[model samples]
Target: MSYADFARSIGLGGIAVDDPDKLGDAWGVALAADVPTVLDVRGDPEVPPIPPHATFDQIKSMTQAVLKGDPNAWHLLTEGIKTKARDILPSRR
Candidate 1:
């Protein structure tokens, strides 16, 4: 059984999967609940780790899409890279 179901089975309060904003609200609800509570959040399960030579735009896009708007992920992805793909990669056109 899921965390929510498990919590409810034992007479505790819980929150189940929902949209991003709803998931945040669920955390608030879980915190405020008097009894023990569970906040079961669901999200993208296959976010890849940042690459060794990832670029600014590459890291930015990946952070926005896969990391769910995490700014720190972008910073980490681009930390030591001095140049972007546009600076080093040859244009196909």
Candidate 2:
């Protein structure tokens, strides 16, 4: 099926994706380039590929800023959320 049709059939109604592997690519880009996986850096067998960059305090501060409707945090938080939502969308159907 066309990715769009598959997406719609699966109830991924508004999202757009051209390729399945693109999700992994996007994750790599985001995890490396954009926001970074500031959460959950602990890896299998107990070794992490990248050291934790942001502390819980920093994360909490960002969360608080977001909840308080700070503009910069809004863009940052929504990009993180949208990237994560995109990662999970294909599994719903």
* Best by the TM-score measure: 1
lDDT of each: 0.63, 0.46
Backbone clashes in model 1, listed as residue pairs: none
Model 1 spans > 4 angstroms off: 48-93
Per residue, candidate 2 scores C-alpha lDDT tens digits across 16-86 of 33454455554564456432222222113221122246566775765676668654665566655554455
Best lDDT goes to which candidate? 1
| Candidate 1 Cα lDDT to native | 0.63
lDDT by residue for model 1 (41-86), tens: 6544433444667767886676567457565655544542322443
What's the TM-score of every candidate structure?
A: 0.47, 0.28
